[model samples]
Target: MSSCNSAPKRVGNKVKCNLSFFDTIRKRPIGPSGYQIGYDDLVALKLYSNFYHYEIDKLEHDSHYGGIFNLEFSLDGKLLVAACEGKQVLLFDAANQKQINSVDSAHQNCVNCVRFLNDKHFATCSDDTSIKIWDIRKLKSCLRTLHGHSNWVKNIEWSEKDNVMVTSAFDGSIYAWNLKSHSENNMLYDKVFLMNGLMRMKLTEDGSKMVIATTNGYMIIIHDLNLATLATDLRSFKPSLYRLMQISDQCYPVATIYNYLFSPTRKRNRIEFIDDFPNEAEVISSLQIHPHGWSVVSRNINGEENEEWTSVHDIQSRDPSDYENSFMYIEEDIPDEPEPEEPPNQRPTDLWLGYISLDEYSNHNRDPSQVSQNIWENNFQLPAMGILNSGLIGVNASYNAYFQQHPEQRNKVITNLPRMTHFIKEKNVGKGYIKELCFSSDGRIICSPFNRGVRLLAFNNQCQELSMCVPDNPQQLKTIVEMNDYHKDIVVSCKFSPTHYQLVSGCLGSEIKWYQPVV
Candidate 1:
């Protein structure tokens, strides 16, 4: 089912690319006979995006699909599972692109995430507000259905080290299920992580740190999941830190991860970017943590500019020792509107400084949607994709002290960290949402969803090119190669093979394109 084509029928005299992928070894990008590059993996990947240009018109395509929400490759890379807007979960043999099994209407609503616990076992979560564990061996029925969220369950992360299942959703809550207990009542712990617009959470491969992407346009990071590694850098918002993501006066979100450092309390720690980073625009639509956990790749759209950028950021892990603990709920960032002067005896309604017990404020944000709406409106017409760190959740001393320490930054919103190292990428993705993105196992490339197709963004071939002091110039780093001509509809999900140099992607056109390099 594969053939070696020297060039696609409609080859361009000048292929669109920034860096020469194979120039060192070959005068021409592709040898007349086909990929002759000594590196098999590099040739396979290069050909998937570059040589396919010669066969642009001949690219094989499948029948229409309702819409694909996400795709996942099993750790062994022998199997692929797709979660679809059609309410169907599909399993396929990775090598041949053949349907192995499928569960139609797997969820009452759109299935958002499909994760492989192992080659034979997998998990799925949906807008139906429930997470189901399935035995791929029996696709007909799920092994267990865990329900605890009050809204759409956007994502699920498994911590193999602690045998715990973590789920986060639009409900602004994170819940952990102890699989170790092996009981129907396995839901271990639950807590609201944000006031609203919480959409996705990702665990680094080691599960040491977790990053969250929210609709309010922020990235939240939690460090030392199992507390396996302790970070001693405890100066949260210490003035010595370099600033980056500043957009006028508003803060952007970087991350908010609940640390297990405090044991029973699960003390929360976060970075509030009152503006700092590689770039601006945080209405982040998609996020993926790198396998090694040092960084994360996130996609954001500037609704105001009608543009999107995929950014890579270092995970700035801060130690929780600055103050034992204090968690606070922040619904409003600094608004451009002049602050309303408060009566001598009146508490600021928008600025709830008096630690009115967390529960009393909890009622103020019962409806997630309203909280987000009121937050943005009260702050100002937030016009783009971004995140700023807010307050943590614990005691008042630490909370008030956090504010007092940075009196000058009091008006600036708090979110994720500043000092976003690595990369910030922009693409001419005209219209539609880029809902999902992922990093290959080696972390050398990013499989990012483009408008109607997909983009393959290369990082350092070795992935350790962190020597630059300033962010790389945005003039096309020659890293992102588009495999876009193939898909006719907005591509929603894609994944790289963990076991092979293969790729599988699904689109709103209901077509799934599997790219396997033919030597």
Candidate 2:
């Protein structure tokens, strides 16, 4: 194991830091009955608090034990729900984060995605080749199951303002559902079979355009999407003209802009795109556009190959001639730096882990048109911190060498990793991979799925372990909390409330865990 001393230290308020157990004191917070607060809860409180004056209640669980692929919190952050592989839909009270109710067979098979249509209603899609709508008040059954797709439903995106939702399936088909009229519109793009299959899709801020990512690494851009126009006459939904661009030969392109699209490469420390520019690659992963559509954040995938590094990139457009010269073109106001060198004996502090984008939960209530005009102002300028060492190692040697051919000055423009406030590790929980991590609306707490449970870390600028006590013996520090009651199998997906401190998570065994922070 690498020595803890090798880890970087925080430099004032800019970087959050964590301390070793032996380095702490014994004056942790005491609860109302004068009892020492639970260790796990105490840790959560500290992680979420600025003064460490608070305490978390205890570990809570739900009835199911399957691996969850996704979870979402309501807009108010009071309710948490999830879709499980076991074909179950689970619910919980966001205030206490405990299981309140669930539907054992929300679908005939695995539920892949869950989305909220509004405060009282939500929708889910599953491997059973259908989508079901449910109400939070009645958890025992679904309100309706919408059928059409002949394959697993991979994802669902809804526009509450338009009262329409889009569902994409494994069969390369896209279906539009109208909440008001209860109608469906099928998308039949020209040359659809040439693009392997539909992998994912993104709607423009006002729902006027959709950037569809296909399995063949091409982006199909469709415009003029109107349910009213389409429902009245089916042909109205068929766009007469569509724009297509080749992004990758076969790799899945994850994010896109009006003029640019982002795709992944097997290379270490970089993501290339299919845009015309001085540079076409940046170091990022799981790139997601902000709800407002002007900015994007990296979901920051960590692994041994890339040193567990990830960063957020701001998209700004600039005059091409400003960066042009006889020999090459370059972005202005950005400095060049050497790529980070992987430590010979370094190991990822967190391994087999997954990530969820802040874009997924941030600014859900705000009008997409008003997010921040300055969001795209910087125009792809790397964050000031530069590339960070996530302590994970794994690199594609061939791809790395090929991309390395670009001048160091071009490859040098990249962002750094976000500061890690604290690390929460559970001993008894098996080392099953974590699929997603989410932060509460206020940015106070973050939660990620665990092997058989979910782990939460309350976060703020302060490091409170200085006064908290560590167990007298090493073995005594088994875990901060054991959330195994939620699922008997591995937990996979999770989401946070857009406005509250509540959380929702799911597992592979098809169970859901709803957790709330109790002070």
Candidate 3:
């Protein structure tokens, strides 16, 4: 292992962190006894926190699990299921951390994901272009198998409010399955919508909206979906404009498309607040909304002021009244603190020197002998939204020296040269972009799958450090832990235990490891 206390990178006065300090607790192999766990191509982690540490458990193998693509737990948290690349579903007893059952050929091809409907009923999607609902009680058979997509089924989500399930596939089609009412011959799902490269889909807390992430870097937003009427309108649902369609008589689904850019050209330090939609000036890698659906947490595609690292932001409507109320309550409850006095020998802070343009100089009738210092002050004129700027300008040092040498020719040379007011961004940097990220239900802890490791971050919402109070500095998102190197290759997925203080991680090396914070 490398040094646990590895130094952070410094860019200007900012600190960039590549978290690499978490201690390994234990490793669980997923394949046969003779095979090496590190090279096993494990794609997902489905371990439960109920099992005590030091329990060495392995899922039984048939041929070999091509790779564990996704893992899920039953509702009661007693059973663990692993979706494998060999179209297999392995069931394990969570209490003892041992394999109890296995379905060798659950699907025609590799299984991509597994989600539980209830304790005994669970659903799995596969690359074979089908979805299967299985009951653990009847180990040999599947309850229902749904097929519609022409490409691989990538994701599946259950909506409890409507008693329906939504699935997305690689072919860009989305299907809705009405659990209460199936078609004549046990046809599980009815077609809902179609779009290209729909890789992932997540439903909001209230089931009013669905956020779809595509392979082509577009986020599809579907709003005002009436769950009560979804089953009835499945057949007549159409995507078009102007003339009233069949669903228009009832309720039409409102959809919007945002072209998400992974690399935006604006400066990172400037704040952009939007009231309706995201500004689209930053590369958004992953997006998660708060439980209330009022706030959005997004991971920027690239890390600024730091090398090979990224940052996250909490974007919400700015309510000045909320801050004022908070400030009033805090003032009434606490005593005032005294301000520290500055030392006599301390010099004033240095300010960036800027030159006024010829037009402004001519209008103001400025004196030539007096030196002007650039002083930026608080000029609050309402926060801007969806605005982009390059930032501060950079001029050639040799040009400045040449103007200084020839004082008489300075005005002539300055007049000829173009005046730049904004800064230009640097090209292509920050290779360590996050591919997948998940936050806990409470929004305190974030787990993201990075190259060969998992990044655990703690959000500093209170702004604890004094230096972090700087207005132009980066957000107070800190990497609290890093789990890496033990896995042979890239980590594909990670999840937090809903009921325990543990995290399960899955890697491409055919291994699933359960990690707990060292207390």
Q: Compute each candidate's TM-score over C-alphas.
A: 0.66, 0.47, 0.53
Better of 1 and 3 by TM-score: 1
Q: After superposition, how far is residue 299 of candidate 3 from its true place, in Å?
A: 7.4
Clashes of 2: 28
Model 2 residue 133 CA deviation in Å? 1.0
Which RMSD values do the candidates have, in order? 9.6, 18.6, 24.0
Least accurate stretch of 10 residues (summed lDDT) in model 1? 235-244
Model 1 agreement with the true structure over 336-425: per-residue lDDT tens digits: 534446554542222221112223333333332332111123232222322222333222354456457644343333233353544545
Model 2 worst lDDT run, 10 consecutive residues: 250-259
Question: How much lDDT does each candidate structure score?
Answer: 0.56, 0.43, 0.46
Candidate order, lDDT descending: 1, 3, 2
Kindly report the root-mean-square deviation of model 2 from the true structure over all alpha carbons: 18.6
